[model samples]
Target chain A: MNMVVCIKQVPDSAQIRVHPVTNTIMRQGVPTIINPYDLHALEAAMALRDRLGGTVTVLTMGPPMAATALRKALGHGADRGILLSDRFFAGADTLATSYALTSAIQKIGESRPVDIVFTGKQTIDGDTAQVGPGIARRMGLNQLTYVSAIPTIDQEAGEITVHRRAEGGVQVLKTKLPCLITMLEATNVLRRGSLPDMLRAERAEVETWNAEAAGVEDIGKCGMKGSPTKVSKVFAPSPRAEKAKMVEGDTAEAKARVAIDALAETDPQLLSVIARQPALAS
Target chain B: KSKELPEHLKAYKNVWVFVELEHGRVHPVSWELLTEGRKLAAALNVDLAGVVLGPSGEGTDSAVAEAFHYGADRVYLVEDPLLENYRTDPFTKAMTDLVNTHKPEVLLLGASTLGRDLAGAVATTLATGLTADCTELAIDPNRNMAATRPTFGGSLLCTIMTQQARPQMATVRPRVMAMGEPDRSRSGEVVRERLDMVEEDIVTKVLDFIPDADSNQAQLAFADIVVAGGLGLQKPENIKLVKDLAAVLGAEYGCSRPLIQKGWMTADRQIGQTGKTIRPRLYIAAGISGAIQHRVGSEGADQILAINIDPNAPIFDFAHHGIVGDALEILPALTEAFRQRLAVDRLAG
Candidate 1:
């Protein structure tokens, strides 16, 4: 199996802060981490490589600095890393993003017949879980999204069975190989690479591909120009003016009472809730 | 190659919200979108319509009738059992057919699991742009549907526009928009549409739906009050403090997406981007370093109280009130405080 995992570099949301006067995120100095969700996807791919006897390649489309994420993927047991960086790829939405990625995958496929493509369920920055599906649609890869478990793999039969997170339920689906999968969080635990893996990753030369090198023919379809959607503005939501009625009391029991009383007046439906559920009262 | 619409095709107007039904029950998110769509429709000075696709029969009629009561001026109904199980192939075909036949300026769907799935497929089929999980939607002065949603994982808000697209599309998370009162006497014109595609063409089959276990499911969407903790809780065991606080406040307990990602909290109890959208009376965010993704999910809360040791936390920007304190210390304090206050109030009453 020639497995490919896509990763993204994002600002650590924990340390991300907004300027008081500007009301915009102070992104300049904040450190970036390989998106936590993508780490799970990379880990899953590496595990499959180790178990099935295959090579794992990590791919990313971002600024040149995103090579750091590729290095991190290499450090975590990936065999090779490719960075698709170009000025034309900036400000691409999910559709345009999928185009660039699909074109790059096609380029990579020229060298190796790709068996599986892995992506996080969604990126923290994009938050739209559409790219995985978008890429699958473009590449005609069988998309298995929100996948919780890769229960079994029939290598000889060229098929894989997975547990998917559907609405209000789970769906167990079996599909053929050469598919795109977006792994749900916590599906598999990421493994720590040995000292040799870390040392090799630090010294490994990552291959870079520009749009032309990635087989992107129409530059218009690779970035913001190809994206039909445009973000017009972003602003802080209007703050609520009313203050919370701070309730004070001595004992935990008494405090519960005050809070419940406020709940009764503010959200009166809660009073009936307390009346109905005795477990809540005590 | 002119992709521009002919003058005749450009006459289509108004905004439409697809009233989604599953297993014979109308999803509550439909009503929420109706309330939101009504506002957008009024602002755009166009009729607010609903497109209902289900098995042709009593249930379909009732769903369309309910749409009128919820402020839709008209309801487009397509009755077919093939539409029964919310299949992507049939639903997408039905919706796109409606859009092609009677074009709407803006289309809205609830950002539920079903809505997200259907919206993406349908939008792609139509080759139209779609903004998913929009926290806010409004008509710009140009009458374009301006969809404001969180971007960069909810660290920032991005207003997206689908230029040159006839039907601007967006999906809103459930509970983020308020549902208006149902005026049962309200009436609307209902048009029955036909499905030309047969069931055989649909490739994917729904073998079965294993319902979520009761223990694993959290009714966070409809919970009136939510108490959620973030990394500030310090240890996984400290999550008990969140449950205790929620108990005193009569609120459901959840956590930021990280806690869920970290396996510190159940998937259902995660409250942020990719988790659940909650619009509670009060949302007490403790130790949560509100990322744009998390903030977008909870920004709809009527009252947001943020408690964090670092006053510089982004959660404070949208929080109704901010307490510069340690969550581990303040949580116990607040829990104890609420517990006592509630007891005295009950005694006084």
Candidate 2:
């Protein structure tokens, strides 16, 4: 089996802070890590590779600095890492990003046929969840998103079965290979890299490919030029008058009671909830 | 400024919202988008329509009725058992075909698992732009639908527009927009179609569907009252206090995204930009700092009561009422008071 997992180094969104005065995001010192969801995707791919004799190739589309992320994935037992980064690829939207990624996936398939492609449900920074489907459309691949588990795969028959998270239930879906899977979060815990794998990954030569090298034929379709969605404005959500009338109570118990009273006073529905849920009132 | 459409896209006129239904129940998000779609249609001075694609049954019929009740001027219906479940192939083909036959200036879908799946596929197949998780929708000065959504992890908001695309696409979460009462007297035009594609042509097949009751799922997003804790709970076991309070009030319990990150709770219980965006009647938050990301997710709540050790925590700024105290001691006290105030029939696990 030949599988490719797409990963991106994103800012640790949880640690990102906002400036109190300017109300602008403080991305200056924000450290980047593999998108948390992508870690799940990588783990899924690695597990498949470990169970079925195969190799997993990790891929990314970022700046030259993204090579660091690729090296880290190698430490997790990926056989190869390809970095598709270029000045022309900057300011790309989901459409352009998918175009570049689709080209890169095709180029990677030149040597060996890639049966499956994996990506996180969405990137933390962008959070669009569109790139994977766009790649599938361009490459004519089966797109399985929000996939919780892959139970079975018939390589010879090009068939795969997966559990998909739907609106109100789990859909057991049977699709074909040459499919793209976007792994949902909390499906599996990521594994620790072995000492030998870590050592080999640290010194591994990361192959960095620019737009041309990555088989991007049209420069116009590579970046901002190809992006149809135009961002006209960027601003912060205006804050309300910042003040909280602190509930007066010396002890925790007094404060808790006073707070609940105030909430009921404001939204009587809070207490009416008990009457509504006959089970609670019973 | 007027939006100039090319010769190809000039035929695009009305605004359309996808009416998402499965298992005979329409997702509330679809109605919310329709309520929003009404505005965009009025602004564009065009018809507000809905596309109901599903198995031929009460699901599609009532969805069409509610679409009109929610102010749709017309509805395009595609009914087939093959379209019963949400598979990418049939849904995409049905949607793309509708757009090709009758051009629409704007198309909206909910940002649920099904919506995101079909929207991405349809937009790509039609070669259009799709903005995800939009917070606001309006007709801009240029006569295009300006879809404003969060970017860079919800720290900033950006407005995007598909300048040249025929049908500008966007997705919004369920509770982000307020839905008005439906008018049952309203009715409109219905265009019925069939699924041209065959089941054998579809590669992906649905084997079975295990309902939500089969899993230990947290119903946090739609709860009327929600009590949530943050890292301030300090220890894993302290989460019991949150559960206790939720049990007394018959409310759902959730946590800030970090608790999920720390494995203290399941991912479904996380309330944040990347998790579930909740719109409860009364949200009691304890030990949460209420960062912008968390704020974006929970701001939809009608009233928020934040309890934290720091009075300066940002949560209080937006939270209606607040108490500055340690959640460790406060959660137990609050749970006790609520337990006595509302005698509950069941105790939490």
lDDT of 2 by residue, A110-216 (tens): 99989999999999878899999999988989989999999999888989999999887789999998999999988999999999999999999988899889888
List chain A TM-scores, every candidate, in order: 0.91, 0.91
lDDT for each candidate structure: 0.79, 0.88
lDDT of 2 at A225: 78
lDDT string, candidate 2, B140-253, tens digits: 877788999987777778788898887999999989987768999999999987778888999888899988773647778878888899988889999998988887777888
Best by DockQ: 2
Q: Best by lDDT, which number?
A: 2
Which one is best on TM-score? 2
In order, the TM-score of chain B in each prediction is 0.90, 0.93
Clashes per model (N, Cα, C within 3 A): 26, 0
DockQ of each: 0.30, 0.57
